[model samples]
Target: MNAILRGVRVIDPLGRLDAPGQDVWIDGGKILAIYHHIDAAGVPVVDLTPPDGVDPCVLCPGFIDLHVHLRQPGDDEAETLETGARAAAAGGFTHMVAMANTTPPIDTPERVAEARLAASNLPVSILQVAALTRGLDGEELVDIRKCVESGAVALGDDGRNSVSPRQLAIALAETAHLSRAVFVHPEDEEMIAQANGTQGSVTRSPIRPVETETRAVNLAVRALSHARSGHLHLQHLSSEGSVASLRRARHQGLAVSAEVTPHHLSMWLPVAEEPDPQALRKVNPPLRGELDRVALVQALREGLIEAVATDHAPHRAAEKSLAYDDAAPGMIGLETALATCITIGGMGGEWLATLVERLTVGPHRILGPASGVPEPRLRIGESATCTLFDPNAEWTVGETPLHSRSRNTPLIGARLRGTVLLTLAGGRVIHQDPARVPIVSEQVTSV
Candidate 1:
């Protein structure tokens, strides 16, 4: 694992480092040193220096995805822990929070422990969250204490929205004692049900309107205020109203954090008609109007919304191939997240570092101080987990050769402006774009 990344730009927000043309030395499993020049006489090297006309690749703290769906313990055909980890590494995520909404759901202490063990060996750390309600049925609460004790990073019922703010408040009250956060899918289920009608598709109908999310956010914020304990994390906020609610909640001194998804930020509803209409773009809290999309981007830039999660839900092709109203609501994003954000998010200059911070430090905030997830920084003695990406590299999304088992994303055939060139997790080379980086081996001497 000893190597030096040469001529790369380093961006570590927590460490207050944003420098270019630095050589980062990695030894064992931690960063050894960083300088303008490191003697490569005796160590393996990865040439991060781009060829003429190309921008130098960026090296930043290992990206953390706050929301991901590893359809394991049930739907393996769509995604397994191993497959999902592969996709994550490919996308430059050193850590990801796996939602607890599987077949049977990870609602018990035993299941949470099992999920951790199942992912223990993956290159990226999979922090599994426990279901807020048993079976995600929203009827009964799970053993929140035992689940957290068994190593669940947070509590959530993502696939199933919270039944009521009261239910969420009770769950928050329980997690408050544990010093953990409750990740709530802030969409009013009753409103969605009534709006979509029984058996109606969310995308086909008027959809889960902005009110569905804003109302839930307001109620959840009030619930958190009443509980007066525990951190409340709103997941995949897609509307201006939701962002405003979060701002108000934070202004009131509530321990609240929120995440936005790549799809919601880049894409919008009233999807353009293709030769053949497809359900690939359908998602819960379905993409709002263009104004909402613009608001999300601005919120992210201003740090009002803290994290950018992929909500990397993977479903079988058959599940996604259904009619617009009947198809599953999710898109595989671990592989496309970074590039999509850079391109569609309009990230550049100072905002680039801000985007990287959201991907790294922001998720850690939602995990809470008690989760034991390391602060993502590159420094002497810090773990050598980081990502190197070519921000100006243009690549089009293809229909085949995807790392994820699912191909439910609407970005197929769309050209993206950025791509990850290398991803290192704990000094391990989990992913590398070989053509761009040439690995050299030798014995290292003093610089």
Candidate 2:
């Protein structure tokens, strides 16, 4: 089967193509051709004439989250692979990396295989990251080669930082030998004593200081120096000083990349002062001051921040209802990431294009398929992965409209501008507006 996506603009940052009024053709799960017009008669076409009252929209490569916890095989009450992938598709995401912090921890080949099999049934792509140590205890290293062969993309102890520098060095060395990257959660546990919110004068709560992140980064960089084969990727960096340290490491020619979440870029810790703890403003690497927020935005604009990931960790209502110290450390982000990027991050069309590239191609280079810009017009002969969004459409978020099983999002009631009109993965329209006719799945394939 062949499908045509017509009358939509194409946006690819690396290719410098941000043009409108083109048609895309996908055949057998690969983009065959993209042009202003397709003359073939047998192929089915989906005419996407921009509604008269609505502004023009843009079509780009689907997003890929570098850090996510699907919580399958354990902790299903919070989220599962099937439900999480649905949430990812609703947010215009085509792929996501599942963190290694599962119930038993993804530390063995069998566990990695189980996760991949479970995720294979979903519409989107799910890549598992194996544990850096057995059971994530930071004691003994897992079988790096076997885990990678069993479908693990990388190795990491996502929830907890390794305790000993020697243990970390050994793991990095093994990963380097296997030609894989090691994703580090960059936090010095010693500094994490009862730290809840951001460390600043605006809040009376004692929060984890900036040194926690810097110390972990410095240690990871030094370990990389000894084991130079693998790259070090940092997750959810919040402080300005941490960014500076990463920039300096990159300047010195170390292989390093870092990601920032939307909550950190758009909100600050002052919101925690609200009387209602249920407001869902508090998060890990807790929201910083206005200064830190501005710095993070600047880093994104200046290329210091390589990617913007959701860290889409979901928790249940009961889990988030507890006191500040007792509540879980995450908020639902996959559903609202792009909207937050466009509305709050002040990203224009070009910047938005760059962000999409960072979310898809950039991360893909680090983990999965080789990096390359999605061709213009979204035609056939290319992988059938695309995201269609209304850039100027306005919508208010609420609990009833959210697709995630968990309703712990912080963006509820917030007026957002961009909206995902349709999302396709492997030539299948996993999510489409009910008002529009759905596209049939042409052909499906996965890595």
RMSD of 1: 3.8
TM-score of 1: 0.93
lDDT of 1 by residue, 19-75 (tens): 989898877767888899998679977777777866677899889998999999899
CA lDDT of 60 in candidate 1? 92
lDDT per residue for candidate 2 within 264-338, as digits (tens), equals 877723222342455376666777777777888788777778788888878878777777656677788888888
The pairs that clash in candidate 1 are: 42-443, 42-444
TM-score of each: 0.93, 0.87
Pairs in steric clash, model 2: 25-380, 30-382, 31-380, 31-381, 31-382, 32-379, 32-380, 32-381, 33-379, 33-380
Q: Candidate 1's error at 60, in angstroms?
A: 1.0
Q: What is the lDDT of residue 108 in candidate 1?
A: 95
* Native-to-model Cα distance after best TM-score fit, residue 146 in candidate 2, in Å: 1.7
What is each predicted model's overall lDDT from 0 to 1? 0.82, 0.74
The C-alpha RMSD in Å for every predicted model, in order, reads 3.8, 4.6
